[model samples]
Target: MIRLFDSAHGQVRELTLRDPGQVSMYVCGPTVYDLPHLGHGRFTLVWDVARRWFTFQGLLVHYVSNITDIDDNIITRASREGTSEELVAKTYEKSWWDAMDALGVAYPDDVPHATQYVAQMVELITQLLEGDVGYKTSDGIYFDVSRVPDYGLLAGQPLDSLRAGARVETNDEKRSPLDFVLWKNAKPGEPSWPAPFGEGRPGWHTECVVMSLELLGEGFDLHCGGFDLRFPHHENERAQAVAAGVRFAQHWDHNGWVMVGDEKMSKSLGNFTSLTDLLDKNDARAYRLLVLRSHYRSPIEVTPATIGDAERALARLDGLARRFGLVALAGHHLEVKDDFSWSGAALELYEHVAAALNEDLDTPKALAQLFEALSSANALADGGHEEEARELAVALNALFGALGLSLVSASAVVDEISQALVNERDGARTAQNWTEADRLRGELVDLGWTVEDSPSGTLIRRP
Candidate 1:
């Protein structure tokens, strides 16, 4: 069994599945209006690791992550660029998937787009209205927080306190400051969907509740997102389910933000680095390794220094793979079942890693153990205990693979053109032509080789 810190309860609890041997989880995904930021990459990698770990432990995992294809941001971007909202959503959504692929995050079992679920969202809103927990205002339908007794449960605040601290809204039509819109009235020249409430689109909070319930059903195993979503977004989603007298998520989990200096990396902060930009500059696996090095619920900094550290750590893992001739185990599932075999040092290391992962997915602790084992395995091989070292190396490779970090073997055979470029770069450095050396390095990078400088010469390899 796995344990996670349930945000609603503010404590770590065992993950009690709705069905035996099966896990169903919903992670709130990106709203594609622009390029995804580092924060987006962090949350996605965190949940993807959790999902992979669940599967690696022999649980049948069904993962659902939703995309907000229709949002105020998408509409604004469309209007600013004089394009259709559909075109803007499609363009950025493609970019979102491209980044996900680069990060090695697995595609969800189901990706419910908000536009595709508008009809279902409307139906949910109608149910809330009939239940008298929702009210129609001048702008749109608002969910009256007053009606839901535990409206702020996920926020870890009482309703009165939440209202007291909430920012004053311009919409005086709403009965309470904490009230959230279920449907938004369409503005002129904005995208609209025909609904019973009016010709308007569904609100941001409404989409997740409706989609998660429809796809994963009531009381799914877990609902996850970034810590920022735990407040108003997740709170409102839970409120709607409570208002409608339906069970929502069984457990709530959230990962922490990516910090740039003291501020959270977000578009509004004007401090966000594009995720694609980082992927282009560094090895794609470096970001995933960075995420693993830190506890998921703790804020992480993504500076060049930290990224470079992760890259070097990955190189160390690759060195072990090269020495042992270990095959990459990524994209393959390893199940610890009844007939599974383990022995000696491999079994001992596996148990230690498993215990760490089962405890609230303590990846940092688990990784520490793995790296320590990596060192021991290298020492054993050096001491002529070849078979013992090989077994432990195989286990290490699979363990890291289970966490979605695939170790690379020795460098691939460099093409003649790339080899020539590397030689040119080496010659440039020898001749003290700094500008030419830099240009050659850039060319090699553009040719999809990770360029490094060794004592002998330029070392080029596929990342």
Candidate 2:
């Protein structure tokens, strides 16, 4: 069985499935107001890795990540751009998915849109009001935090402490500053849905509660998002579910933020980098590798230096694939129960990787084992153990594939220009003309080819 650090429990524990041999997960997705940043990429990739690992272990996973099509940010962007909210949401949501595809993230089984569940959200608000757990304010309907005894449970704070630390609200009618909006009364020109309270829309926190319950039913296996969402966003979601007397997710997991230096990357911090921009500039697999190099709950730095290191590491994996003529095993459903026809080093590699992953998804430790195996396989091949090396190479391919990273083999046919440069660099090295060799290598790099030295000559591949 897989174990994960449950945010609710504040420690790593076994992931107990609600249904035997099955996993149900809901990850909070982007709001779709702008292009997805690196933070968005990290969370999606983290969860995607988890889903793939679960499948690799022979357990069926039903993953549902919601797209927040309507939110304050979306409304603000639509108004600023003088466009319809629908168009803005549709356009940016496409960008979000394109980036996800570039990052090799698998599509969730069901992607619930907030706009599609408005009526259900309205019904939920009505239930809360009828139960006397919610009250109406002039601007909107608010949930009374005091009514939910464990309102700040996810936040790891008592209600009184949370209230004291909460930002002072301008709305004096609110019973406590911690009380949050359940429904926002629509403005004159904004989109609105008919509710008994008034013509308005659902609040941000209310949408996920209604959709997750509607789709995954009560007490889903796991709920996950970025660490930043653990507080007001996820806490409020759980509060609403508790007030309604419905069970929410059984396990809560959150991935750490993507950092730009000491600060977390965010639009407000002005340190955010577009995930699409990074994908365009570097190998998409490099970002995944960079993410895997760190613990899921530890912040990762994504600078040129870090990305360049990851790209070089990826080239080593690709080199291994090229050496043995290994085919990619990505996108194939290979369960742990399936016979792999393995023995010796290959079997050991698989067992070590599986053990690392099963222990709280320790990807960093797993990757260290993989790299060590990569070196050992190359050494075996050098020592005339060709068959053993090939077996290990094939196993490495399968293991990386299970992590959603596909290794590229050498190009069978390089363009004449790139081939000429590679030959020139090899000749320069043979002639002991170090300056000329360095210059030629720089040119090849400038042309978007990763240059590496090989026994045959300079090996080049598209990064």
Candidate 3:
């Protein structure tokens, strides 16, 4: 069984599924308004790796991530651009998917849009009202925090304490500061959906509650998102489910944020870096490796130095792949218990990786085992143990693949002109003409090959 940190319990616990041999999960996806930031990339990669690892461990995984197509942000963007909200949502949703594809995140089994589930949301709110757990006001319908006894369960605080620290909105009709909106009343120029309550849209918190329960059924296996969502957002979702007399997610998990400096990256803070910008300038695989190098629950700093270090690490993996002629097993499943040949120290290493991953998805430790095996493979090759070295390389790469790391290098496709330039660059380096060598390297890069200096010679591969 895989153990994960349950935000609700404030502890790491085993992911016990509702159905045996299968796992169901719902992860909060992006709000379609602008290009995705690195935070978006980090959360997506975090959950993607988890889902892939679960599948690798021989469980049927049903993953659903939602797209918030109609939100205040979308409306603002639409108004700013002088375009329709639908166009704004569709355009940015495409941008979100493009970034996900570039990062190699597995497409979710279901991508439900907020606009597609307005009716279900309205139904849920109706139940809350009928149950005396919700109330309507001049501005919007709100969830009554007083209705739930343990309102701040996911916040890891007592109800009274949360109420003391809650931000008070002046001129609001909420009974308590902690009470949140179930539905936002519409404005003249905003998009509106008709319901018995009024012609307005669902609040951000309402969509996930209805969608997760509807698609995955009650008591789904897991729910995951960024740590920022743990408060208010996730707690509110949990409250709504309880108010409606339904069981919610069995386990909750949240990944840490991507920090730009000392502060978390955010658009409001003016430190937001676009995922597309990074992928265009650097290898997308480098970003994934950077994520895997750190623990999932720890905040990660993304900068040129860190990304460069990750790129160098990726170069090592690719070099090992080139040396052993290893093929990628990314899209393939491995039944590690039976499918692959396991024996001797190689088998021990594989088991170690599996054990580390099982211990609450300790990817950093698993990565350490992989690097250890890599060093062993190199040492064995140098000592002329060819068969043993190949065996170790294959096993190490298989584990890497299982973790969703690709070992396949871009195919080297050097045309005649590029080849001549590469040859010239090599000659310049040999002659110690650093200036000319740098110039030729830039030329080769422009021709679509990332050049690297190695002890053997100048190495070139597609970026």
Candidate 4:
């Protein structure tokens, strides 16, 4: 079993699935107003790894990540650009998917768009109103935080304490400072759906509550997102479910943010580098490796030096594939333990990986074991222990693939132009022309391919 730091309980606990053999999850996804940043990349990668690991552990996983295509941000961006909100949402949503694909993040089983679930959200708000827990304000329908017991449980603060720290809003009709909007009454020229509460759109916090319960039903196994959402966002989501007498998520998980220098990397901070820009500058896998080097809950710094270090580490993994002619087992579902027959020494190393992952998904510890095994396999092969080295190499690549890190050979994806340059560089090296060889290698690099000189010859792949 995997133990995770559940935010609601504020401690490490075993993840008990609602069903015996299946795991259901809902992660708060991007709002699709602008290009995704490093912060967004971190959250998506964190949950994607969790989902991959759960499936690797022989569990049936159904993951649902929502899309807020109709948020205030989207509307603002649309109005500023003098276009329809739908156009803004559609354009940026495509950008979101492109970035995720580049980062190797898998698409969710169900990506419930906010616009697709307004009717259900209205029904949820109606239940709250009839239950006397929601009240109509001058501008919208509000959820009276007073009606929900322990409303600040996720925030770890008392109701009064939270109210004291709350930022003053313009809506004086709200019962208390802690009260949140359930539905926003429509404004002139804004998108609106007809509801019992009048023509309006649902509030930001209400979308996830309605979508998760509708798709995963009450008491889904896990609810996850970035730590920033732990506050009023997630806390408000839980309150709605409790007010409606529905058992909410059984476990809560949140990953820490990606940092730039000492401050958190965020759009509001004006420090967010576009994820697309980063992907264009380096191998997309480097970002994923950088994220895995730290614990999921610890703040990670993303900088040129860190990315460079991860790229070098990836070189070692790729070198293993090139040396032994190992094939990347990407997208193949194998009976993890049963698919491969391992030697005694290799089996022990494999157990270290499983144990580290089981103890709270300690990926850094697991990766350390992997690199150590790689070093040992290289030493054994050099010492004429070929059989043992082959077993370890095979196991290492399989585990890497299972963890969503593909160790593809450079020969697999290098274009003809890049491959021709690699061949030319090799010919120069064979003729003992060091200057020409180095120049050709630089040319290949400028064309966005990583060049490697090996015993078999030079190989090239996208960086």
Worst 10 residues of 2 by lDDT: 330-339
List residue ranges in candidate 3 displaced over 4 A: 263-272, 331-339, 417-463
The list of candidate 1 runs beyond 4 A from truth reads: 262-272, 331-341, 415-463
> Taking the tens digit of each residue's C-alpha lDDT, what string does model 2 give over 319-343?
8988988776554343342535568
**Model 1, position 370: C-alpha lDDT score:** 99
Every candidate's CA RMSD: 5.8, 3.8, 4.3, 3.6
How many angstroms is residue 174 displaced in model 1 relative to the true structure, after the best TM-score fit?
A: 0.7
- For candidate 4, lDDT tens digit of each residue in 1-463? 7788888889989999889879999999999899998899999988888888777667888999999989899999999999999999999899999998888888889999999999999999999999989999888999999998889999989899999888867567888988899999999999999998799999999999999999999999999999999998999999999999999999998999887877665656545389987888888888889898999999998887788899999988988887788987643333254467756767887789888987888999999999999999999999989889989999898777657788866465666787788788889999999999999988988887777777777877665
Model 2 / residue 124 / CA error / Å: 1.0
Per TM-score, what order, best first? 2, 4, 3, 1
lDDT of 3 by residue, 309-332 (tens): 999888889878977889876643
Question: Any residue pairs clashing in model 4, and if so which?
Answer: none
TM-score of each model, paired residue for residue: 0.88, 0.90, 0.89, 0.90
> What lDDT is obtained when candidate 3 is compared to the true structure?
0.88
- Selected candidate, larger lDDT, 1 vs 4: 1
lDDT per model vs. reference: 0.90, 0.89, 0.88, 0.87
List candidate 4 segments past 4 Å from native. Answer: 263-272, 331-343, 412-463
